[model samples]
Target: ISSHVHYSGTREDRSSRVVETIEFTTDRGQTVRANPVVSDTGTVDRSGMSVTVLHDRDRPERFIAPQNGHGISARVPVMRIGFGLLFLVVIGIIVNGGRMILGQLPFF
Candidate 1:
């Protein structure tokens, strides 16, 4: 299994941090993409870029791209969980959204 990283460009995330959009080819020959907001390495332009990444054994899409001996902040996963909870709550509300809004009985 071989792995590699490709740096496309940078974008300012909501946190005002400049993040690099990278795509990596997994050992399974599947390409996974990630945006790492913090990198210890100076920077890599389109000219060429490379970095090492460790992925989940069961889910390759979840990975970490460490730069210059530093890994990205761990709070990211916490945020993902929060968003997932919010999504579920929204779906629950929508299940009987009309009833809830109209103050109807037997809200599902």
Candidate 2:
């Protein structure tokens, strides 16, 4: 496991510290590498940080953890057939009922 710490001071003399790099062993007995970064926010005592992960089989890029703790893999197309079938069923019902009821009403 390897790690690095850095300190950066802004022009206003306010200092900020950031820690990066993490190495650990996975359940499969494989080595994993990651870099965690911390940055200062506009508010005092508040900062944002993220980790960049490097995978053996995938591309290396920075990834921010989801706010809700749920990670998304990829995007999928929205299924339209279900909605289309629902719309057709409603239209068929409305048309059939309209004809039956209108036929009994006197048009004059």
Candidate 3:
């Protein structure tokens, strides 16, 4: 697998993106090139990295690279906690606003 960094947009709005290309030989002795599956960290100058390719039995050209799967990482948990906190804050604001509106009502 070959990884390359691609830049898009003008100077003001430029963004960097990583693309991974995989070259493999099919059973029929045909060389095929396809994009490999990559994780978010795949773009960090990890060029010429070796990756395991899982190809389709019928269509050898169609393939995917599964990222290493284990338990939850620190990044995911932090994101979840942040989103949960944001949700709670929003819910709390809505409930507080409703309570304020009900307090203004003539009927307690």
Candidate 4:
């Protein structure tokens, strides 16, 4: 197996994405090469990285790479909490502004 960085986008905002592809022989003596989907934890140097794959018995081409068993990235959870707090703040401001507008009406 060989690994390389896959760069995407224009020169101003280029992003470095990493992907891993494996070459293996099936039980029936067929050679197969495919790219495997892995988690995104930022730029990864998969160069010379060795991994073990488990192939499907029914379909030899199908395979899976065992995960490291770690949970989601730290940035994901932090962003979720940040967005939630921001949403609450916006809602509170909208409600308060509406009440203030209503109090200034002639009906009051």
- Candidate 1 lDDT over residue span 74-100, tens digit each: 566789999999999998889778766
Per-model lDDT: 0.61, 0.46, 0.71, 0.69
RMSD of each: 11.0, 13.6, 5.1, 4.9
Error of 4 at 54 (Å): 4.0
Top-down lDDT ranking? 3, 4, 1, 2
The TM-scores, one per candidate, come to: 0.38, 0.28, 0.53, 0.51
Best lDDT among the predictions, by candidate number: 3
Superior candidate under lDDT, 1 versus 4: 4
How close to the true structure is residue 2 of candidate 2, measured as C-alpha lDDT?
36
What are the clash counts of all predictions, listed in order? 0, 0, 0, 0
Say which prediction, candidate 1 or candidate 4, comes out ahead on TM-score.
Answer: 4
Ranking of predictions according to TM-score: 3, 4, 1, 2
Off by over 4 Å in 3: 9-13, 37-41, 69-108
Q: What's the residue-level lDDT of 99 in candidate 2?
A: 94
Whose TM-score is greatest here? 3
Could you tell me which residue pairs clash in candidate 3?
Answer: none
**Could you give candidate 4's per-residue lDDT for residues 35-91 as a string of tens digits?**
654444355555565556567767766765444434434676799999999999999
Q: How accurate is candidate 1 locally (lDDT)?
A: 0.61
